[model samples]
Target: MDTLGALALATEPPTDNLMKRNPVGRREPLVTNIMWRNLFVQALYQVAILLIFDFDGVRILRLQNESRSNAEKVTNTFIFNTFVFCQWSICSSII
Candidate 1:
């Protein structure tokens, strides 16, 4: 047989045992739990930071001031709030 054929023949098909041997799958349950706990904690931290930085009285006042009329101001505020919510959702998914 050619070298390529010989090499191909030497490789065995994957099995459950092979999957079990993977380094990623060998982590302890405690390690996996800790990783998940950290991820949730970080996500909460990011949410808190975003809330602190993005939603302020000054920003609301600026939005209110930019509109020409009461109806326009309400519409503008609704759009701005929707945009902020969408941004937060995207950021949370990314993080």
Candidate 2:
């Protein structure tokens, strides 16, 4: 905890010693509270959940049924996220 505390303190204000110590500036926050505002009524909210369950999140989920022994396989969300990130990374690096 001391290390984190030191880093945080060091990064604060003119004391940006931590930022200098490791010169890469940390990423800024992407999402904010304003972006999370719900635009649905009570009726529409339930319908949205039903739609998600019926069609899935852009086919992001799958179920394995061959397991009589409780085995399962699942696509990790990070797998998709990383794929997208790498594509963007390569494209941006080319620039």
Candidate 3:
């Protein structure tokens, strides 16, 4: 019983030592400043990309059409086969 009690006490953390080691007051402002600076820089980069890149509505529509056509061609074979099989099964069942 004493050994078990000692083991339990050993497993528990020394909060007093940990509290002394931590410098929460000094680090919070530094971390918050870094986070704000990072966000500001990211916002500036996004604005620059929008201003300099060809990201207009017409270019977006053209890219969407090209992607759709390419995807249709890639999936055409499987789609056609499934449709034909479904139609054949329905006709055979009805007849």
Candidate 4:
């Protein structure tokens, strides 16, 4: 067997430690998967609204205000806050 085959054959399985089992964090659905998935979806929705605003279009945040869905509002707020923090960090690093 070659080096690649040898490495594959030598790999050991993970231990049965449920407490330290979160290897992928939010990417894998062990814990906090529902929250992460919702946040991701909200981020995508926010991005779509921003894209609409980019080329001389109407702002969608106003329309969101007219809706009675608390979940949607919370998701939009989370996405917006996440973006702002990212922008702040990027700008701070450059300054």
TM-score of each predicted structure versus truth: 0.30, 0.22, 0.28, 0.30
lDDT per prediction?
0.59, 0.47, 0.54, 0.55
| Candidate 4 structure quality by residue, lDDT tens digits, 1-95 | 14544465467455679448755655555547786886687678767755555432223344444545664565567556756765565445434
- Writing each residue's lDDT as its tens digit, candidate 3 over 1-95 gives 24555576678878987878956785466557777886687567655544433334235334455575664453454445545665455345434
Sort order, lDDT high to low: 1, 4, 3, 2
lDDT of candidate 2 at residue 50, scale 0 to 100 = 47
User: Model 4, which residues run further than 4 Å from truth?
Assistant: 1-68
Please give the lDDT score for candidate 2.
Answer: 0.47
Cα RMSD, model 1 = 13.3
Best candidate (score: lDDT): 1
Model 2: per-residue Cα lDDT over 32-86, one tens digit each: 4554443234336555554554455335443443342322223334345545564
Per-candidate Cα RMSD to the true structure, in Å, reads: 13.3, 12.5, 22.0, 15.2
Summarize candidate 1's per-residue lDDT along 1-95 as a digit string, tens digits: 14545466468577898778847554457457777887788678666755543555335545545545764555556656855775566455544
Query: Measured by TM-score, how close is model 4 to the native structure?
Result: 0.30
Candidate 4 residue pairs that clash: none
